[model samples]
Target chain A: MATREIAGTTVEVNDEGYLTNPDQWNEEIAKVIAREEGIGELTEGHWKVVKFLRDDFKEKGVMPTIRRVKNAGGIPTKDLYELFPEGPLKKSSKVAGLQKPASCI
Target chain B: MMKRVLILGAGTAGTMMANHLARRLDRKDWSLTIVDQHKTHYYQPGFLFIPFGVYGEQDVIKSKREFIPDGVEYIEQKIELIEPDSNKVRLGDGTVLAYDILIVATGSKIFPEEIEGLKEDGWFKNVFDFYTIEGASALREALKDFKGGKLVVHLSEMPIKCPVAPLEFTFLADWFLHTQGIRNETELIYITPLSEAFTKHNCAVVLNYLLEEKRIHMETDFNVERVDETANRIIGYDGREIDYDLLVTIPTNMGDPVIARSGMGDDLNFIPTHKHNLQSKSHENVFVIGDATDLPSSKAGSVAHFQGDVLTENILNFISGNPLKDDFDGHANCFIESGFGKAFLIDFNYDIEPVEGTFPLPVIGPFSLLKETRVNHMGKLAFRWIYWNILLKGRPMPGIKTRMQTLGKRLPKIA
Candidate 1:
């Protein structure tokens, strides 16, 4: 199993550096993961997306889609790009301490 | 002695021709045989969706035997040589099969080694391609960890299968990054040898607008000299450099090596074929289809489907001693995925460029032309099912004509 050092803790990651166990994630770990993803810091807006994704994943047992994120998380399409840069769902999902969304590819 | 028809490859063109000819030709008169190295048939168009994880492995692969109809002999062997003088093909296992007619459907392959440093160091690691199943699968992993950086999507040269695929990848990359929340941090660059975004003038104009809209930096006429891997940049013949953090390139595509060894091909090993009838210029008994033929049309599945229909009739006419008709008009139609659940459809032939139009109907099409719509995206998704069930089986599609029609086309006005 692949592993990554986050916040001085060794966490399991898949071959693509996505979190293997959602339980291993925390607020500090999200900050470290965001930095690694090139997002210098996670703001309140970022946290809103992260929290929404985590809560939705907890309820649905699956990562929310871009449409769901945009609708439920209240993040518009433009703001989503502004926040995540290249892959908002993928980046925010990682920072939000959730598994990679299956529908992304 | 019974007349024999031997097809070289069991791919799209080969499989369709085999199915089409079996029904048309007499059972006792003609014995059809198809030779290919593998038993698995890949829905190659689906390879474009693989890297994006839009399609899984099982979704694109099927047993070749499933599509190859009865009354045809399936020979699983690598071809050794084609002695056109004697009209015989030698298989790798020393079996020589003589044919009354031969169809060359062996398609093009990516020649990664042809480019310097392409196969070295970062291949499948950072620098990757999605042209093959393995390459696409590897790219899925590479794209996962890619945090905002310079992502360069390049085409080594022209005449590659599905020419619009690179642009589709670029557009999807923009969407994919946006979904990953790295669109701001990433710089998406599209490098090509063509002066414009696409092959056609008017189409390139619209595509260039789309590229500008997506903010994908276009570097045109970039004749790649070599990949300077240590410096993480591609050096063109003109000494220009484009650096990349992640490089997804479509390498130089060439016809099967067997075509070269047999002295039956051009500089790129593509068989010189009649653009109209698809018959080989060198031999009347030989017919070429798909990417193997040096046709002026786009080397796409739609062209192959159209050529298959025409070639089937021509082959029958040839057997009956009738004059071959100049039927094939290089008709091709493709759905260009433009990201965000919308896609654009372009339909054209040899003479006409892609114009604003409705397809198969006049101004009341269920699908629009040269314009992006969710319906076109649905059509694009529905095609995979159609390709397997309807197309490969040689069944005619309703309302989709084999010939190009100008009925609903909105032509450019002369100034």
Candidate 2:
């Protein structure tokens, strides 16, 4: 697959709009991938979630579940759903353009 | 016999239109005249940052005459009425200026008086709007003594300049109160008529999260019925009362008074303009731009800049008796300030809503769309300089285009 450029990040999506390279994600593509996954508009506070998700994936080398993303992002469980609205972790991962981690069924 | 074009206001919209049309129209063939009541031009968007001590009054104001080109004649006077049938405009001094073409670019005004009880006792006492030079300066004073309480930032209605400013105010207020050690003392509340914090669904989702994260109280769909200034309470249409110590209300906005006197506007006094062509629905020889028109978009300076380009083409076509191209797709953009030294940029036109994407370039926008970044905050600040030098001078920005592009934007799910 050919690499497409988005804010210095090399992104390649299949017909289903999945990121071929999850590690290649930057802030710009993170928003694009999130919106594509139905996260809608990513606001200022949502950055906390994005940063947390990216950090969790980097350290754990695996995608974080809702519980992990909540703990990592430091946002309350109620606030997480308000921020993601589409069910956190699952929804945010799809929008962040991150590949599904081995932990998630 | 030279063709004379008279532009009614020398503010942001009028100044840009003059700069554009003066260059397009041959000086020998067409005489351009711009009339404004005040000699000073104000950077309106700067008003948003003023209350927070981010921008000073000196940074936002400039002489209106300085921006008008040498070839363009600027007359500082009040317009009494537009005699469109006779192709003449009457001035306050009883001087009748005739024109071959008239451009109505007089921007909007804040009518705080329209809101009962708001202007009577608590005009600038407890309630203030950061939309005008005086209001902004006064709010700065009010903020100085603002120790703590329920600090409510609100929008009276939609169609306000820089729609995100109130949201920006809420964010900045959160940052401001926290820095002052008053965050715990103050209860930050955002009272808007919008179902969410913003108009568009996409942006609203992000804003709702911001309100939640910042611990700012959000009361959506609360249409303010009146303000009980003595009691420091806002009464909503649904009989909901929100108490506040300091009320920063973005008052009702309407088009210039000239539109009402001339009978060229709708109920709200906004000109009825052809959405695409920029031609006034009232007359063929007249055109409307900026906040003067009842366009279903954010009444921001960027939209006027884009309209200036489109109107330039249409005006020439009108002069030549050629078919006018309806090309302006309501391209409006605004940098949403999110405080804590971060901002978000959103660009869209009539058909398209602001979506997540890179702007200017498909994959490499230094500024993020719909997401707050420190760089976007810098861009918003940098625009103040650009407005004075480039945008108002009628020069084309090399990187930025007049048209809104969907190249980088991810298309919404096709329903």
Candidate 3:
């Protein structure tokens, strides 16, 4: 496991730099991770996706897919890409403190 | 003096040619040698299934030596240059190998760096390509936690190996996302430089309809100029921009660099080949096959398989002082995986477009042409087995002819 300091908080990451443990994720850490992903700050739209992903992952023990986030989280399909540029699920799931999704490619 | 036959790149085309020529040519009259940089032989078609976990790492890799016949010498070395005039090739180790006959089968490769920002910041992180083993493995991990957004499958340019692969990936993505219950949330888009879903008009019509049925957006004639990693968008040469949450792109495909260095190839390093005879236009002794040739054929494995038979016959004819048969009709057969346990099979040649019909047999086709069927899916699955055991061995498949068959094809009505 690789470890990185996001907003002064140490987080375990996989080989691809995705969060290995979702339990250690915090809002501050997500902002820092977003900055690292080239996004300056987490907007209100970004938080909606991040919170939905985190809440759903905690409840279902699995990360929420784009459909789940749109249908249950009330986020539109276009807004997801708007909030998280280039690999919204990957970037948002990482910000939400979840493991990297497998097989999107 | 023994007639020496040298084959470059012991991949699909070269390996099959080595096996085919070894069986046909006289042992006393010819000595065969095949050279490749890597000792491992990868089932490249299986790379498509890797990200989906349908094929494991071990399933695609095998020793190149195992495929080479006993009489053929296999050299694991990089080819430095091909001096066609001298009838010899220079190896990376400075050894010169002279040949009476040469076969160039060094296939095409993805040039990601050719596109601006393609190999920059977001490469392998946000932007992923499943064209290679490492790329596929990395993509597999990326897909696991994907919540979803705009999943764009882009083709940087045409003349790519397995032209249907991107379509297959797009279709499979739909199935995968739906299975993960994210299909409705994700916007699936396929962007190609071509004006339609595919190169062939008839096949494109069917494929376009399927794309509409699956709710996948098709962006045609999208000639990508650059990728803005920071903006998460792909910009076209015409200033068209498509935003994507995730992008799977097939970069520009180019032939082997050795061909360019040898000055024996076209602008893209593909050997100028005779479309019907498979012989190099510049050098009579040199024959080109697979993706290495500048022939108007799909750069797919099936074309290589068909070319293998035609090339072997022509090479023998050239040696025996006989007229070469122009039998190679650019016959290409491809099985398109349309997801949901169904696939479409198409058979066509240089002159004919993909039409609705049965393959190999007239009335009774276990496989349907230009139509999706479950049995076509089975045939697609069964091909991987056939590739290793029969295709690689250069053995003839029963009831399958090398040339395109028009026996059962229902041609499209002329307008």
Candidate 4:
């Protein structure tokens, strides 16, 4: 079992190798998970979007749109767009360790 | 009594073996045959640069027979199976090729359909991959007309060829979107099953910083469950889902299907070749190389090139009834594109992971190991040219050695 702290939250990866708590997921969590999963690197912007997705999921029971996330997460739309430039619907969200959202289509 | 050599799938590895063997064996001594269903050959690594308009589709494709030696017989048919014990190969047309030496270079296949729902609803509609010529050309069209929305790149699984390709796509997409002035309209995401940007901790550290600088969002530890194309979402095993307007994915890559038919492959159709000797464990006269072998490393062109050298020596030794040398150290080198027209190089083997060091020579390196530079980017582009002319010809590359050496590599200084 491995334990890591992401953005002030302690996330525990159990012996079964699953991240035990969903709340422990954050930007750092995304980075840690990326390393653990063989995907490389998570930036601060990645954290901002992942955290937004986590928070959005908690609040609305749905993953927020990239546009919705930009405003809600306090990140400028341009920065968010630039961060994802391809749009935030694909593997970027997966790499952030955020749960897939239904409205992602 | 002439010796017969049957080469499977006249791709890079198969074609190179045919050319090399043709030069090695006289017509009086041996007969060589190259088999492939497709008439055209493709430069696979160039697929990565294609969607970015760096390399056109036409630039990467050529006739498979174009590079094969004139003396080598080219068989245009699908392989049915390999009877290794009997030293016989069965073709789709019921033709049997009896061989004294068999080389399995059938390479890999993209099974996007293997992933649940990946090919179901939004396969070509929204989901795309650049690993193939058709996929790349389609992705180019998708990227050209794509105005905003969420764009995602996913690595279906590990051990895929050119592991850094997804990250390169992310960076290039950023560059592409920015250039088109639609940078504000889109969001880019990169999802993978890996813990970091790369397998190596050192490279991951550098790439992590770069991802931050580029503002590319990432999702780690995502084991994709299904691609809900109808709903336009990627669902994970953990019950999370990502919606996308466009999905560029490196779908599940498996060994060539012919391996399974030949009863010479593992669960994924990858041939179980001896890690060191590159020989088929089931048969003495059979050998495997390139993406076909179940080796623990990135399935890149360089690895195939290195394996070619080792297999060449081992094959000759087997012919002479000499003790075979397991000299292949699993050496692999890759040029990583780090966006902004810069790339990085990493050279390592099975024993030594990629470390921060100068490549080729000590004190001065034409290309920096684990560090991004324009020179490395140029080198990445230059490899396509070399692939066609020098590498396919089985000619020796200057300053590049098949075995990995760690002389000038600097160990990380601990505090």
Q: Which candidate gets the maximum DockQ versus the true structure?
A: 4
lDDT of 4 by residue, A19-90 (tens): 555655555656665565454576777666766766676775545554355446777544654455333444
For B141-189, candidate 1 gives per-residue lDDT tens digits of 8888888899999999767889999999999899999999999999999
lDDT tens digits by residue: candidate 2, B56-122 = 9899888998899888998999999988888999999999999999999888888887666788677
Candidate 1 Cα misplacement greater than 4 A, ranges: A1-105, B413-415
Backbone collisions counted per model = 20, 3, 14, 46
For model 3 the TM-score comes to 0.79
Best by lDDT: 1
TM-scores of the candidates in the order shown: 0.79, 0.79, 0.79, 0.79
| lDDT minimum window of 10 residues, candidate 4 chain B | B406-415
Give the per-residue lDDT digits (tens) of candidate 4, residues B68-187: 988889999989888988999999899999999999999887898878888876766678989989989888888888889999989876667777788888888888889888877888
TM-score, prediction 1: 0.79
In order, what DockQ does each candidate have? 0.01, 0.01, 0.01, 0.02
Could you tell me the lDDT of residue B411 within candidate 4? 65
Tens digits of lDDT, candidate 3, B1-415: 8999899998899999999998999889999999999988889888888877788889999999899998998888999999999999999999899999999999999989978899998899879998898898888877887898999999987678898999999999999999899999899999997778898888889999999999999987566768999999999755579999889999988899999899976546778898999999888899999999988898888899999999999999999999888999999999999998899999999989899999779879878999999999999989989999999889998788999988888976677
lDDT of 3 at B263: 91
* Minimal lDDT window, size 10, model 1 chain B: B221-230
Displacement of residue B167 (Cα, Å) in model 4 is: 1.5
**Model 3 C-alpha lDDT versus the unseen true structure:** 0.87
